[model samples]
Each structure stands twice: as structure tokens, then as C-alpha cells.
Target chain A: MYQELLTGLLNGDIRSLARCISLVENEAAGYESILEQLPGNNHTKVVGVTGPPGAGKSTLVNALITSLLEADKSVAIIAVDPSSPFNFGALLGDRIRMGQHFNHPKVFIRSMASRGALGGLSPKIIEVSDLVKAAGFDYLFIETVGVGQSEVEVAGVADTTVVVVVPEAGDEIQTMKAGLMEIADIFVVNKADREQADIFAKNLRLLAHTKHQPGGWEIPVIKSVAIQNTGITDIIHAVDAHHKAVTGQHQRQLILLADRAYQLIQHKRMKDINKQLLMSEIQQLLEQNSFNLYRYINESSCFTQRGKEGKEA
Target chain B: MYQELLTGLLNGDIRSLARCISLVENEAAGYESILEQLPGNNHTKVVGVTGPPGAGKSTLVNALITSLLEADKSVAIIAVDPSSPFNFGALLGDRIRMGQHFNHPKVFIRSMASRGALGGLSPKIIEVSDLVKAAGFDYLFIETVGVGQSEVEVAGVADTTVVVVVPEAGDEIQTMKAGLMEIADIFVVNKADREQADIFAKNLRLLAHTKHQPGGWEIPVIKSVAIQNTGITDIIHAVDAHHKAVTGQHQRQLILLADRAYQLIQHKRMKDINKQLLMSEIQQLLEQNSFNLYRYINESSCFTQRGKEGKEA
Candidate 1:
């Protein structure tokens, strides 16, 4: 069954691709084998669109998708919602936002939940995107809720990352600037039709231009009314230009690859230990007067003397 | 020096207490000794105040501190900002918000920056709060920015968690519900003087009452205009009530302690390895094309066969 799904995924069968993605999402049995067989280095330009909630990320993504489709590029979107419980609410909202391209043959969109585990989201996104990339799309756009920490993780998987903000996001801009400055390849001041749009755009441009980014690439702050489909062409242009400039930066690529590897390996190391079981064990241990977490971990199989076991393996 | 600080902490000497907290926050050498020496099982109530930016958390905290002081209770406030660069910017903001209590003899306030290491903040908060509890304060208040995953973590350290939100948070209230509901022991609809305040408070009460908490204690939603000091006393009353209600829930205490221990152990396991070193090693491995992260991690001392090393040590 896994082999059939793998073949179907490789053959660009949507049903097979969807089923495989679900298996990966659920971490179902045989998922590891599927990941091991995934084809890498597809040269698919993964563009990350991230910003605060209500930054119209979905609409901007929809507009960006329309433009990419116009450029004769096949696009696959992984819309990531940082909400927990893995419910259908956020997915429904994202679907409505990008409803225009629901039937387009060249476009595919998927919504994901964060699943509430630390260091878990990145590897999951990378694995799913790998499946999508293996299916032969020219461009992959990963749209994430650009609150805290999520954007930084999403940056690892994307060649170019676009941070979207609105005119009314005055206070958030300040709070987000510290973290967002380092990861953003391009900045978009969306909702340019709203009040304070010009001032917000100006402020963003000043901030972006003053920041000294490596690779001699100047981070551009583009103004857009994504709902009305204005300024998206400029965003696409910036993404392409930035991609071209960053292509020769071997050090940057090394860092990105290292980050990807770090999360992937961390996930693998943690895969065997069931957190639920560990919690129960820890609870039992806590009942004892001398329960120290470090001592317990040092004694547990999770961090046990692996040298002997590792050597044997 | 560590011994002296530990002695001072136990004796409730303010200078020694401050120095020890700094040591723990910096994770300096000998800080672990100080943590190990910290007094446990103090009757000090640790209350966590968390909410989105602009939710008036600092102001609410200040009001609560004033009320606690009026009740003849000594209070210690630890303001944790989940921003990087670990600089003085956010600390200054927090200080200004709580400036009125700067010279109050019974009030102790300190600001913290969330240094960018994953899973670092929780352990640090727990350590600092431990120090504060050791100092014999009647109440310890921890205020954190409630944008993302940070609040859930901060909740682990608090016996009763107060989540503050303003009426203007229309859509965000819904989005934050899933995460906030699980952690909030008391909800504060601050800025109750504003439009829709009554409705927002009613909605919050409805939501809070509907959620099935582990403890039979029903979460109370209080309305407050914190700046005006309106409804602040009711918040204090609710906190005291919740604290009294949950004091006998041994299972809840076990879960909280388990979370604390998990973060501490995780930090300990990750402490010795430098991220830069790991990245460089991974970079070299990635150059070989067939290099996978799992193989590299398994080979590294970070996850090496600990059994051999354990016996030798």
C-alpha cells in the first residue's frame, strides 16, 4: 500500500500525494520509509509568505499565486496555521481566502496545524514540501502565520521569505522587527489602501534599507493592496531578483541546509520516545521526594548510554 | 560566591537575591549550584499574567500588585518578554510600566528577555521564580507576552494563571481561545471602559465557563479597566479563590511539576553543545551530498552512546 502511494505521488497523482501527505502529517506507520525514498534537490523555489494574523496573508498568497500562474509556473502552496488541535476551522478560513484558484490545474493548496510540539513544525513542513516538490512544481509557496518563532522556522525551508504587514500594524511592527529583520528577504506593506499606508510603507522601507544584509542584496519593502491585486507583480519581481542574487551564496545555503538537518535529526532522535508515556513515567517519578528531572533523564532510555547501542547498530 | 548568594537568598537579603537571579538568567557558571540550593515548598503563590501585546498586562499587574500590597502581602514580579537580542529595550518598557512600584519597599520587579535558544525560556523562568519563592515573598507574579507558545510555558510555573485581554481583540479572542483556555485560571477583560467591553466580557465568561478544566474550579472572567483601577480587586479575589480551590488537587500539582522537570531536563541535555559548532559540523556533512541529519546527530557527542560515557564519568 505504501509502495503504491509512493508511485502515485511520483506520478503526480493528486490522491496519492494527498494520502502520502496525510500519512506524513499523522506520522503513520511506514512514513519513515516514504521520507527515506523522497527525491531531494528538485530546484523548486520555495517562497515563504509570513506575517501577523489579519495581515491578509491568505489574500496576498492568492494574488501571488495568480501572478505566478500568469508567468506560466506551476505552484504548490502549503498554508500553515500555527493554531493547535489540528482542527478544520483555520483550514476553512484559508480555503475561502484562496478560493479563486480552487479549480486551477497548475495550483495546489494545503493547510496544516502546528500540532503543539516544540521543534516539530519545521521538519513536518519540510517533509510535506518535499513530497510536493517531488511531484514537479516549478514554485512552492509556504504561507505561515507570522507571529513569534514560526517565521524563523519557516525561513529554513524557503529560498525567499516575504514578511507581510498592514498599515494598522504600527505597534506590532516594532515588536516583530527584532526577529523578522534577520529572516525577511522581502517585506510587503499590504493593505496599502488603508490609512497610514504611505507612512507605514515609508517606515518599512527605511527600516529595510538601513539593515545591512549579506550577499549585497538590498531588502526591498513593496507596497501592495493584495485584495485588489495591486503591487503583487513587484513582490514577485523582488522574490525572483533576490533568488538570483542569493543563488551564489554558498555559505547561506550551507546554513539553511544545516538548519534543515538539525530539525530533521532532532525529530528522528525524539521519534521513538512517546511523550505521553514519558509524562506518565515522569509523573510517577515526581511522587518520590527526590525527583529531579535531569537525574531521571540521564537514567531513562531516551538519553541512556547510547554509545554501546549505537556502536552495535 | 555561589554559596554566599545561596545563603543570602535563604535569609531573604535583597542584594544577594538580585545577584543570584542575574546569575541564573545569564546561565553563568555556578548558577546551577544556586538553583540546587533553592528552598522548595514555600507557601508563596505564583500567579502568571499573560496576554497579547497591548492587552494592558503590565498595568493590570501593577494594579494587582497594589492590591496585594494593601492586603499586607509582599510581592515579587518577573516580567518576561519573548523577544531576542536579550537587550535592555523590553526591560526598559516593563520598568516604565511598573515604574510606580520602583521604590516600593515590599515590591520586587525584574524584566527578562527570551534569549533565542529553543526551550530555554521555561527553565530560566522556573529557576528565577524558584529564587523569588525562596526569598519568602507572599506572592510572586510572572507577566509574559501572550502572543504564541510562551504563555502555555509560563503557565507551568504558576499555580493560578490570569490571561488578560482587551475588548478590541475581536478576532484574536477567538484565535487565542484554544491555547489560552487550557492555561487560564482567571480571564481579565481589561479596558472595560471601551466599546463592546460588556459583550466581550460576557463572551469571555461564556467561553471560560464552558471549558472543562481538570480541576472542578470554574474559571472566572473578570471585567477590569486596569488603568482606572476598576475591577482590580475582584481579580485579586478570584485569584485567591482559585488558589484555595486547587490547593488540594494533587494530580494538577503533579502535572505542573512534570512540565517544569521536562523543560529542565531538556535544557540540561542540550546545555553543553554549542549551536554554532553543531551547525558547522552539519555544514561539513551536508557537503558530502549523501549526508543526512539523523546520521550526524547519532554520531555526535550530543546524542552519542551515553552509557559508555556515563560509566566513565
Candidate 2:
């Protein structure tokens, strides 16, 4: 079954790719063998588009896809929304926003809910990204549901990260955590026809440049009105320029690889912990009226009582 | 040192409160002893106010504080923002928005960063919440920098969640994942003077009630121009009403306690798996041509060599 799916995946069968993603997402039996067999280090150019909500990310991606298709590039989009496990409706709006690209032969669009990871990015997303890359897409756009915490994590998985914003976000830019500035390769001041667009764009450019000068790769801030499909060609050009700029930055690439590896290692170590078993266990403990979270974890054998920090018996 | 701090903390010394929070946030030595000694399950009424940005949460929190103080109630607020670790400026805007209460001895305000949790919440917030509850305050308000994924997690920590919104969020509400409705105990339409405020409030009331009939709590949809301090009294009354509704719901309490315990256990188990160590190891592996993330984690001795899934030999 695995061999058949993989052959179809490499041969660009969409059904095969979808089935493979589902298998990896659910961590089905022998998913590890499939992931390990995927070809290593493809230059598929993973680009992440993220910003605060209402920043027009879906519209921007629709425009971006149009420009890429015009140049005859195949694209796979992983739209990640941090949603309720119960709410499968997260992607319905994306379908409406990018309706033109819904059935396009060269475009593959998939919406991934933030699967309740202890942190922001699901471990499955990294595996799915690799699967898509092995499927031989020319570009992979991982567009995130722009909010507070998940933006930086998305950057770790992408080669080029685009931070989108509007003129209304000018005040917020000042208070932004500064990590966004470091992660972004390009910034788009979308809805650039709005008031304060030029001023916001200029200020953002200043902020981005002041953060770092990595390999003299200057971060460009482009102004676009995504709904009108304007300034998309500029975004595509900037992406190409960024790809050229980071060609030999081997050390930086290694760091991102290490970050991904660290998350993978930590999560895998937690395989023994089943939350259902834990909840039932804790319910019994709480009835004793002495349920201290700190003390309980320190004494519970399942959670590091094998002893770190030398505080345990 | 902890003994003196505990005495001061119990005596309601503000300096001691700040120091205790820092100690817990850092997980300083023997801090678990302090937590173990603290009074268990003190009724401190943890009310979390959360919503999207531009929704006037801060202003509503300001009004909430004023009403609480007027009735001789002391309030401690923990503001959680998922900001960059590099940016300390996340709280500066909070300070200005909540300026009058900043220096008020009766009101204690603390800002908590997300601290780059692999998920959206820091485990530290739970510990800090427990610590503040021990310090003898009438109310503990956890005001989240609400955008997306973190909102539901905040709900798990809060006994009563107040989801604030604006008339503008009406469109986004239809597409919202059902989890928000489940978590919110109260919905506030802040900036009710804006266009469509009444219609939006009516729709939200419908959405909030349709999801569940929890103890017949009747989730109230409040329309308040928080800037004008209108409707603050109604929110306070609704909170009081909900408090009475949840009196003997021991099962619900047990579930929340278990959830918190689950997070505690998960983080504690991850203590010895340091990222810095993992990075050095992965950097070396990347130098070789065959570094599959899946294969490395599977074979890596630090992560699950003891083996639960039986996939490993």
C-alpha cells in the first residue's frame, strides 16, 4: 500500500498526494517508512505568507498564485488556520477567496488546522510539506492564519517568509515583538491604496532593515492591493531575488533544520503520554483534595520522575 | 528567602507578589514548595477577557477594573501577549491603555509573554495564576492579546471567559470555528456605537446560545461603548450571575483541573531534552547527505529509544 501511494505521489497523482498527507497527518502505521523514503533536499522553494488577521492573506495568495501560473509554475498551498479541532469549517472562506484557482490543474490547495500542538506548528505539517515537495511542485506557499504566536513557527519551515500588513496596522508595527522583522524576507503593504499606506510601508521598511543585514540581503517592502490583483508581479520578483540571495547561506539553513529536528525529537519523546488516560488518572487524584499541579508532575512517574534536576528520589 | 516572600505574599505585599511571579515564571529552585504550601482552590474568580485585536479589550478591561475598584474589590490582571522574546515593548502599550490603574495599590497588573511555547500558551501562566490566587485578591483577570489559536487555551485556564468583539467582526463570526462559542461564557460587543452593533450583538447572542445549554447560564451578549464606560455594570452583573450558575458543577471543575495537569505533565517531561543540544547534533547530521528528519528522530537515542509504539526494534 505504501509503495503504491509513493509511486503515485512521485508521479504527481493528486489523489495519491492527498492520501499520503492524510496518512502522515494521522500518523498511520508505517508512515515513518514513507517519510524516510522521500527524496532529500529538493529546491522547491517554500515561501510563507503571514501577518495579523484581516491583513488580506488569502486574497494576496490568490493574486500570488495568478502571477506564478502566468510564468507556468506549479504550486501547492498549505493554508494553516489555528482552529478548533471540532471546527472543520476553517477553509470554506479560503475556497471562496481563491475560487478561480479551486480546480486549476497546476495548483493544489490544502487547509490544515493547527492540530492543537503544545506549541504553534503541528509536527505533521513538516512531514506534509516534505511530501508535497517530493511530489515535484515548483513552489510551496504555506499561508498562515495571521495571529499572535504561530507566525515565527511558519517562518522556520519556509525558505522565504513574506509578512503582509495594512495601513491600519501602522500603530501595531511599533509594538510588534521584533521577531516578525527578523523572520520576514519580504513585506507587502497590501491595500496600499488605503490612507497612510505609503507612510506605513516606509516605516516598516526602516524597521525591517534596522533589524539585520544578513548577507546584505535587503528586505524589500512592496505595496499591493490584493483584491485588485495589483503589485503581485513585484511580490513574485522579490521571491525570486530572495531565492538568489540565500543560495550559499549554508549555516542559516542548518539552523532552521536543527530547529525542526528539535521539535520532532521533543514531540516523539512524548509518544507514551495519552491524554485520555491522563485525564482519567488526574480526576481520581483531584478527589483527594490535594491536587497540586507542580507537585503532581514531580511525583508522577510518567512525567520525568526518572529524575532530572536531582530534586526527586 | 521563599519563607519571607511567602509571608509577604500572604500579607499582600506588592513587591513580594512581583518577586513570586518572577520566581514561578523562571521555575526557580524549590518554588514547587511554595506552590505546594499555597492555599488550594481559593475562590479568586479567574475571568479571562479575550477577542481579536481592534476589538477594544483593553478599554473594556479598564472599565471592568474601575467597577471592581468602586465596589472595594482588589484586582490582579495577567495580560498574556504572544510577542517576540526580543521585544519587551508588548506591555508598554498596555501600560498606557491602563495608565490610571498602573499605580493604584488596590490593582495589581502583570504582563506575561507567550515565551515561545511550542503551542500557544506558556505553562508558566498556570503557575502564576495559582500564585496570584494565593495572594488574596477578589478577582484575577487574565486579559489575552486575542487573535486566534491562543483564545481557547486561555479558556482552559479561565473559570469564566468573556469573548469581546466589535460590530466589524460580524462577517468573520459566520466563518468562525465553533470552539469560540463553546469557550465563551460572556460575549461583549465593545464599541457598540459603531455601525451594525445591535444587529451584530443579536447575531452573537443567537450563536452563543445555539452551541450549548450549560447549566442554563444564558451567555449574555452585552453591547457596550467601553470608551464611554457604558454597559460596564451589566457585564459585572452577568459575571456574578454566571458565578452562581457554576456553584456545584464538580465534574466541570475536575475536567479543567485535569487539563491544567495535562499541560504541566507534558512540559515537565520535556525538561531534559534541551534544544541547544539537539541543534548541535542536528547540525552535524545535516553535513551528511542523508539526513531524513523522520529517520533521525526515530533512530535518535534521546527520543523514545525505550519505545512505546513498538515500531522500533
Candidate 3:
């Protein structure tokens, strides 16, 4: 069964890719075999598009996909709103034209629900990105709501991060500067037709210039009216330029790959422990008059130390 | 060394408590022995105070502590700012009087630095809270910035959560309702002397009644001018009332204990893996033309599953 799915995914079957993602997301039996056989190295450029609420990130991403499509680049998008669970994408519902790309042969869009963990980004996101990249898309766009620690975490996954903001986002920009300054490679001053757009763009450029990126790529603040489809080509050009400039930066890639590996290892280590079993065990443990949590964890069979089996602890 | 510290901590020594927490946070060698010996069950109430920036959470917490002190109850405060990393508590710096409690015999406060992770709450916070609880304080206050997913997570750790908001927080209240509704056991309309404070308090009361909790306690909306120290007594009363209502809710506690245990297990499983080791390993792996992440995780010794030793995956 795993072999059939792996064969189809390698042969560019979209259904197989979707099925594999579901399997991984649910941690279905034998998912590792499918992940193990995936291609090792690929040229798929992962781009992250993130911004505050009402920042027109979706519209900007839609325009980005449209421009990429003009070049016949296969694009897959992963939409993960930082506030997605609580707000339920109420902000992105009308803004994202993701539904419009449903029947498009070259496009694949996946939206991640938080799995009830409001801890910014999901743990599986890095692993899922690896899986998605193996399907051989020319580019992958991970779009997310720029709240919590997501902006920084997404920067870890994406080759380039594009921060979308509007003319009225002056205050928000000031508040989010620490994270935005660290991660933003390309700044999109979306709704450039609005008042003070040029001023915001200039301020963003000043902020971007302060970051000493190891890849030696200069950050650019592009003014784009995504609603009118203007400046899409210029934005695409900026993405290409940044991509070219960072191509040979091996240490940066090494750091990114290592971070990804660390997360995968963390997930695998935590794979078998079940919450339901934990509940039943605790229910039994709490029956006693004294219930020391630390003692319980130390004595628990699940957490039994393999290396220190004979140690004094 | 662990035995001496554990004895001192059990005797209600403040210095020992601090030292012990440091050891746990650092995961010092043989620290598990200290944890394993902590008292099984104790009667200490953990209260969570969370709200948006400038909602006067620290002030409210200060007032709460002052009230508890009047009753001669020992208190420990763990202040975790959700946006603490980026802002560096620029908002809470002058607002929090954590320094004032340094000389107070009955009060202890610790501020978390987020470990540079902007993820809402740190995983160690739970274990640290357990450490604090074992010190035999009459009450523990966990004060956190109510943004991100913290408000909900804190609710899991706390016996009762007091959500503080100002009269001007109408918009933020609306945006944060989904999370706030689930977690808030008490609402503080702080800075209640301001205009529309009464209306906001009334609206919150209506909202609170919407939740159906297992404890069957009425969620109270308390009006407070925390700066002037008014309403502190009433807030304490509400907290006591909540403690009384939830006293026998065994199933509820079973869930909280299970959640805490699960996090402990996860941390233990992931304890041996190091990022520096991962980077060095990845550097070696990346030298080849291809390095599949899934293959690396599978073949790596750290994630070798004990239960599935003979399996194919």
C-alpha cells in the first residue's frame, strides 16, 4: 500500500500527494516508508508570505501565483494562519482566492488547521513542507497570518519571506518590527493606491537595510496594488533576484536543514505517547491520596530511560 | 546535593525553592531525583492572570497579591509575557512591580525570558509551575500576556483564570473572544472608572454565562480600579469561590494532570537530542549530493523506537 502511494507521488500524481499528506498529518501506519523513499535533493524554492490581519497577504499571494503561472511554474501553497484556529480564517475567507485555483492543473493549495495547539506554528509543518517539495513543484508558497512567533518560524522553512502590509499598517509595523526585521526578505506595500503608500514603502526599505543577511542579498520594499494586479511582475523579479543572490549560501542552507531535521527528530521521539492512555493512567494514579506529578513522570514506563537504566535516578 | 535542596524546599525555604527551580529549568544532572521526592498531593491554588497589553494585568496581579498578603497567605508569581521576547517587557517594565516584592518575605516572583522562542508559552512553564507548587505556597499566580494561544494554555494550568481588560478594549475583546470565552473563569473590567466600563462589564457577564463548564461555577465579572486598589478584596473572594466550586471536580483534574504528564513525557523523550549535534551530523550528510530528511530520521539512532524494534519502518 505504501509502495503504491510512493510510486504515484513520484510520478506526479496529485491525488497520491494529497493522500500521503493526510496519512502523515494523521500519522497513519507505515507513513515513514513513504517519507524515506522521497527524493533527497530538489530545486523547489519555498517562499513564505505572511502579514498582520487585513494586510492583503492572500491577495498578494494570489497575484504572486498568477505571475508565477505566466512563467508556467508549478506552485503549491500552504495556508497556515497563526490565528487560524480561533478566528477560523474569518480574515482570509474572502481575501484568499484559493478556491479559484481548485481546477487549475499546475496549482496545489493546502490549508493547515492548528490541531488545537495555539503554539504559533504546528510541529508537523516542517515535515509536511519536505513532503510537498518532493512532489516536484517549481515553487511552494507557505502563506500564514503574521502573529505569535510564526513570522520567525516560517523564515526558518522558507528560502525567502515576503511581508505584506498596507498604508495604514504604520503602527502595526512599529509593533512587529523585531520579527519583521529578522525574517522579511521582500516587503510588499500592498494597496499602493492608498494614501501614504510611498512613505510606508520608504520606511520599510530603511528598516530592511538594517538587516545584515548572511546571503548578502539586499532587501527590497516593493509598492504593489495587488487588488489591481499591478506590480506583480516587479514582485516576481524581486523574488527571482533574492533567490539568485542566496543560491550559493551553503551555511544558511545547512542551518535551515539542521533545524528541519531537529523538528523531525523531536516529532519522531514524541510519536507513540497517546493522550487517552495518559488520561486513564492519571485517573488511576490520582486515586491515591498523594499525587506528585514529578514522581509520576519519573516512575512512568513510557518515559523509562534507555541510556540510564542502571543510574541512581 | 539534591537531597539537601529538596529538604530545604520542603521546609518552605525561599532560597532553596529558587535554587531548585533553576536546577529543573537547566535540567541539572540528577534533578529527576529531586522531582521524584516532591509531596504527592498538596492544597495550593494556582490562579492565572492574563490580558492584552495595557489592560493593567500586572497592576491587577499586584493588587491580588496585596489582598492575599492581608490574609497572610504565601504567594508566588510567575510572570510570562507572551510578547515578552520582542518587546522585552517594554510594556510591563514600568508597569510590573516585580522588583518591589524582592524584599517582601511572603512574596516571590520570577519572570521568564521566553528562551528566545516567541511560541506563546514555553514547555518548561508547566514543570516550573509544578516546582513552584511543591514549595508549599498557599497560592501561586501565573501572570501572562493574553495574546497568542497563551490564555487557553494557562487555563489548563490554572484553577481559575482572570481575564483583565480596560474600557477601551472593545475591539480586542471581540477579536479575542473565541479563546477568551473558552478559558476565562473571571473577567476584570479594570480601570473601571473610565467611560463605558459599566457597559463592558455587563457585556462580559453575558458572554461568561454562555460557557458550560464541568465545575458549574458562575463566571463572575468584577469591576476594579486596580490602580487605586479598589475591588481587590472582591477579586480574592471570587477566586476563593472558584476554588470552592471546583474542589471536588476530579475528572477535570484528571485531564489537567494527564496534559501535564504528556508534556513531561515529551520533554523527557526529547532530552538527549542536541541541536549542535544535529548541525554537525547534517553538515556531514549534506556533503553528499542527496540527503533525504525522512531517511536520516529513520536511520538516526536517537529515534529508534523501543516498541517497534523489529518493524520495517
Candidate 4:
């Protein structure tokens, strides 16, 4: 089944792509086998959009997708929303916001709930993005349910991270102070028709001024009323500029590639170890307080003897 | 140093208590050793207070602490704040709001930042709470940085969790609809002097009427203006009543105790294992993407073979 899914994904079957994402995101059985087939077929530009809740991120993403489609590009969006604690499902309000685009052939949108996952991105977000890429989307956008710092971490996983903000949320300084300001390749002031838009833009620029870049490129703050579709072209231009800047840095690209490869390998191995470690028997021993995790790690035969000697030393 | 600190903590030395919390919150060198000394001293009651930002949580906590102190109780507060990404220090606004209690001999207030920790409880929060318990506090209040749903996980680690909301923000249905509503042991309608207080209270009562509690206890919604100390005593009484009820249930108490013990032991072992895993050579291997973490775990001889076999089977 896993091999068939991989073949179907590589062949750009949208149904296979959707199934692969569902499998990865839900951790369906045989996810590791699917993941093992991914490394060779996973080249895609992943973009992350994140901001405080109520910043019109979904609308902005819809606008971005429209623009991308205008240029004849296929797009995939993984929009994350907080799950309803009672029902354990996506709130679906975000889905309603993008209802108009539901039937657009050039766009595919999926709503994922945090679902007891820690940090902003689901552990499988990267894997799903890979599947989306393999499905022939020219761009894949990951939108996080922006609560706070976790959103920043989720944005960190993307190749180009766009940090969205509102004009009068009193979070302008807080966002800049939160270090998210530094990570943003593009600063989007959404809901620009609201009062204080100009002042917010000035503050963002001032914050950007203080950020020292070796390449001397300034972070551009674009004002967009996403609901009205204004300033989106400028936003797209800034995104393109950032993509160019990042790809232009040959050394940074190599470092990023190396880091990603390392993470992929680590993730694969950790999933295997975690499956073994979190087994019911081990959990029972842990619950009984009879199992010592340190001792268990040291004595397990799955590891090399060099690791054993290192632990002893 | 850790042993001396532990001894000082157990002997009820206040400065040692403060310094130890600071270290744990900062993940300083000796934090793990402090936790290793903590298990037998787990006697304090932990209560978590969480709500939307600017819901008057800090003020309510201050009022509660003062009321507790009037009864001659020693209190420890762990105020979770969003860390400044630049310096990795707390934003400190929440701590500043409770500054008046900082000098009180019976009160220990420590500000903890999320510090990008995925688990709602910082790796250090559990440890610091242990030290605070060892320092002989009768009550420990953990006030989390109010993001949305994630705060519920922090409340899970506490004995009693209070979800605070304000009048005029929205109706009771909206409050309950918010993710943290179900996590509440006590619902506090803070700023009750506002015009919408009665309506909010009514909505809460209506919702509470529909809730089926297998434990046979209805969650009470109390109205309070923390600035004026209105209904402050009632809030404390309600918290005490809930705490007593939960503690008096033999099955629930055993479950809580068993869960706490498991967490304590697991955390301690993970710390030790993490230390052994971070040795210089292993770090080098990890950097090179050649360190098989599973292999390392399997080969460590310090652990029992049964634990290893359990992992495999």
C-alpha cells in the first residue's frame, strides 16, 4: 500500500497526494514507509504565513493564491486552525472564509487542527508539504493558527516566512520584540483600511531599520487590505525578492540543504525510536515506576557499541 | 552546589528558593540535580489561572495571594510570560503587575518565559514547583501567558485550574465556546462591575446547567471585581472547596498521585538521559548526521536489560 501510494504521489495523482497527506498528518499505519520513500522526491519551495489571530491571514493567503494562479501557478495551502476541544475537529470558520475559492482548480486548501500537537506545525507538516510538492503544485503555503510564539516556530520551518500583522492590535511592538520580526522575509500589515495603518507601517519600518543584515537588504512592510485585494501585487513582488535573495546566497543554500537532510534523517529515526519507547508495555513499566528510562536507553541492543562506550564515558 | 541548594530548599530558606527557581526557569547548569532531589517533597497544592490577555488574571492572582496570606499561608507563584526572543528573558509585564507582593516574606513570585518550549509547562516549571513545595509553601499558583487553547495543557499539570473571563468581552456562550472553558474547575467573571456582568453570569449558569458531571459537582461561576476585591473571598472559598472535593475522592486522588509520580520519575530519567546524550563526541556525531539515537539508547550499559527487551517487544 505504501509503495503504491508513493508511486501514485510521484505520478502527480491528486487523490494519492491527498491520501498521503491525510496519512502523514493523522499518523496512519505505515507512515514511516511512506516517509522513507520521500527523500528523493521532495523538492519544493515551502512558504509559511503566520500572525496573531484575526489578522486576516486566510484572506491574505486566498489573495496570494489568486495572484499565483493568475501567473498560471498551481498552489497548495495547509491552513491550521485550533481544534474544538469538545469535538476534536477544526473550528471550520477558517474554511468558511475561503469558501469562494473552494472550487478553484488551480488551488487546493486543507484545514488541519493542532490536535494535541505541540509547537505551531504538526510533526507531519513538512512531510505533507513534500507530498503537496510531489503532486505538482508550484507553491505550497503553510498557514499556522497564530496564538503566539509557537506560530513563529512554525514559520521557521518554511523557506520564505511571511509574518502578518494588523494596524491597531497593539501587537506591533510585541511582534517585533518577539523575534518574529527578524524571521519575516516579508512584513504584511493586513486590514490596512483600519485606523492607524500608516502609523503601524511607520513603526514596522522603524523596527526593520534596526535589524542589521550583512547583505543590507531592508525588510519591506507592505500594507494590504486583503479583503479588498489591495497592495497584493507589492506583497507578491516582495516575496519574489526574498526568494531571489535566499537562492542567491549559494553558501546559505548549501547549509539549508544540509540542515534539512539532517532533520529528515533524524525525524525518521526518532519516529522509530519513539514508537518503540512509547509502547504500552514500556508505558506500563513507566507507570509502575519500575522502569528507568536512562537504564533502558543504555542497555538497548538496537544501538551501536560505540554509543554504549560513549554513554559510559 | 545543587545538593546545598536542595538542602536549603528543604530547610525553608527563602533566598535559596528564589535563586533555585530562577535557575530552573533559565535552565542553568544545576537545574536537573535540583529536580532529582524533589520527588519526596511533593506536598503543595498547585492551582493554574489562565484566560485571555488583559483579563485581569494577574490582579486576581494578587488578590487571591493576599487573601491567602491574611490566613497566614505561604504562597508561591509561577508567572509564565512570553520570552523576549532577543534576550530569552521574560517580557516581565505580568510580574510587574504583582510587584507589591514581591517583598513579602511569605510570598515567592518567579516569572517564567515559554522560551519556545513546546510543552505548555516549561521543562523547568515542574522542577520549580517541586522546589517551591520543598520550600514549604501551602499553595502554588501558576499563571500562564494567555494564548488560546494551549493554556489548557498547563492547567492539566495542576490540581485545580481556574479559567478567568471578563464581562463585556462577550457572552457566556462565547466564553464557554472558547477552548479553555471546559478546563475550568472554577469560572471567574472578573471585572464584574462592568454592565455585562449579570448577563455573563446568567449565560455561565445556563451552560453549567446543561453540563453532565460524572463527578456530581457542577463548576461554579463566580463574579468578581479584583480591583475592588469584590467576591474575592468567595473565589478562594470556591477554589478550596473544589480542591477538597477532588482530594477527598479516593479514586481521583490516587489517579492524581499516580500521574504525578509517573511524570516526576519520567522527567528525572529524561533529564539524566539527555545529559548523557549530549556529551562532546555525541554532539559531534549528531552534527554529522551519523548519530543513531536509537542505537545509542540500545547500547548504553547503565540501564537494565529488561527495559531494553520491553522496548523491543
| Winner of 2 and 4 under lDDT | 2
**Best-matching candidate per DockQ:** 3
Which is the leading candidate under lDDT? Answer: 2
Cα lDDT tens digits, model 1, A174-201, are 5546557677899998889977899878
lDDT of 1 by residue, B167-240 (tens): 75435446546557777899998888987888888887887787777767888888898889999999988988
Q: What TM-score is obtained for chain B in each of the predicted models? A: 0.89, 0.91, 0.88, 0.76
Residue-level lDDT of model 4, residues A47-89, one tens digit each, is 8898766677888988988888899887888876655454232
Better of 1 and 4 by lDDT: 1
Q: Each model's C-alpha lDDT?
A: 0.74, 0.76, 0.73, 0.65
- For candidate 2, give the lDDT: 0.76
Interface RMSD of 4: 9.0
Instruction: Give lDDT tens digits, candidate 4, residues B1-313.
Output: 5788778888889988888877876668756566555645345778989866567788899999999999998898987765544423233555676999999999988877654322223446656666787788888998875443336555556788888877653122352334555567788988899887898789877766566544776888999999888888998888888877776455444444444433333333333332332343344444453233334444444344423442332
- DockQ, computed on Cα atoms, for candidate 2: 0.30
Model 2, B213-252: lDDT tens digits are: 5577788899999989999999998888787788657777
Q: Candidates sorted by lDDT, descending order?
A: 2, 1, 3, 4
- Classify candidate 4 by CAPRI docking class: incorrect
lDDT of 3 at A99: 74
Q: Is the docking of candidate 3 incorrect, acceptable, medium or high quality?
A: acceptable
- DockQ values of all predictions: 0.21, 0.30, 0.39, 0.11
Superior by TM-score: candidate 1 or candidate 2: 2
Q: lDDT tens string, model 3, A1-313?
A: 5888888887768898899999988878777777878888788888998766567778878877888888999999888754434465465573346577767889888877644331123666776787788888888998876344465578888998888877753233454455566678888888899778887788878878867778678888889888799988998888888888887678978888877776666555555555566677788888888877876666666433441231233
The pairs that clash in candidate 3 are: A291-B40, A292-B40
Q: Is candidate 3 or 4 superior in TM-score? A: 3
